[model samples]
Target: MKNYFKFKVLPYLLYLLINFLYFTNKKVFHHPKLKDDEAFIFVAWHGDLVSQPLNYFNKRPNGTVKTMISQSKDGEIITKVYSLFGIGAIRGSSSKGATKALISTIKEIKSGSDVAISPDGPRGPRHSFAGGVISIAQKSGAKIVILSSKPTKYWQFNSWDRFVLPKPFGRVDFYMSEPLDVTNLEFEEARDFVRNKMLLNIVS
Candidate 1:
């Protein structure tokens, strides 16, 4: 059944797949030391979700980070995959259950959980930054960090964002921007700031 596959079969298979890819890949971080006490809202591109679960957990073993994924079928599958890595996803998006999602995310951040979201996510214009991602940081008092990466060897899908999957034993170079305070930024200003950061790091 479709439900069975989404809830059981898919998660198991994807878990194995990601684990193999992640465990085999060499990750190099380019950012400064990140403190555990500070909650941060990290923004990344959706395509990079391929190794995100392990990326976050491996960086901070407590698995304190969570993400906002859509309610679409792909989102369902990804949510399960995230669970397998001890990561969590808060389902829903700007077009659906936007309010509830915003509230829940704020609570998580306030509770000292680092949260990540793809500003260009769910469905995308691919790497476009939207203003909605800023409000959570403003309201929760969490600073924003732009999460980006470059892999020495990888496969790029022909999907909208050209999703990436790092080949086994490849090297991944990751870049995390300094925590940015968006508390007083206008919506447009915040969006531009995020967009510019992506341009600088080029999350591919």
Candidate 2:
């Protein structure tokens, strides 16, 4: 029964839940004007994921968004949920098989697809930005933008990231940071800059 639910039930429920929330929520985008073909790497806290995919993609019609998902059982369910929304995934956690995932994601960006990374994800010391994203932006020559949000109502999961699921018809401020060219900043400096940008835009 557990296997049946894992393989047959979870993905459908998650897809229905995400779609329902996406349609019900009132979202406000405070983001820079984006170019359809411009490759970008988005930074998001692992917790703020529930409505992000639909909202972000709705604003950009031409590019695809890919993420690095782990190889675990849970990752499989999440990947299926993502595919339902037409989003793609590079299999592997940011920390475990990071080298391969990082390389793959950089290639996707250079090919004009947008990618999103939760700096503290797949397992976490939640909300703390990590260096992998800065490295990807540097190598891929893509702009890095943090996806910060404030939601009027939501449920927080007991998981490490305290993953947030925005409630139905809730108002969400989907404020994305202005694009930063971290390709040239010193490694640590770049990391700090992105982290600070994330901090400034997120509110309680």
lDDT of 1 by residue, 52-95 (tens): 66556556777488889888887888888887777778887876
lDDT of each: 0.80, 0.81
lDDT of 2 by residue, 1-204 (tens): 998899678888989977887678887888788767688998788778766776577577655899888888888888888888888999877668888998999999988889988888878898777688988999989998777777788888888888778888889888877789988799999988888787765543
TM-score: which candidate is best? Answer: 2
The residue pairs that clash in candidate 2, if any, are: none
Error of 1 at 140 (Å): 1.6
Segments in model 2 whose C-alpha atoms lie over 4 Å from true places: none
State the displacement of the C-alpha of residue 192, model 1, in Å, after optimal TM-score superposition: 0.4
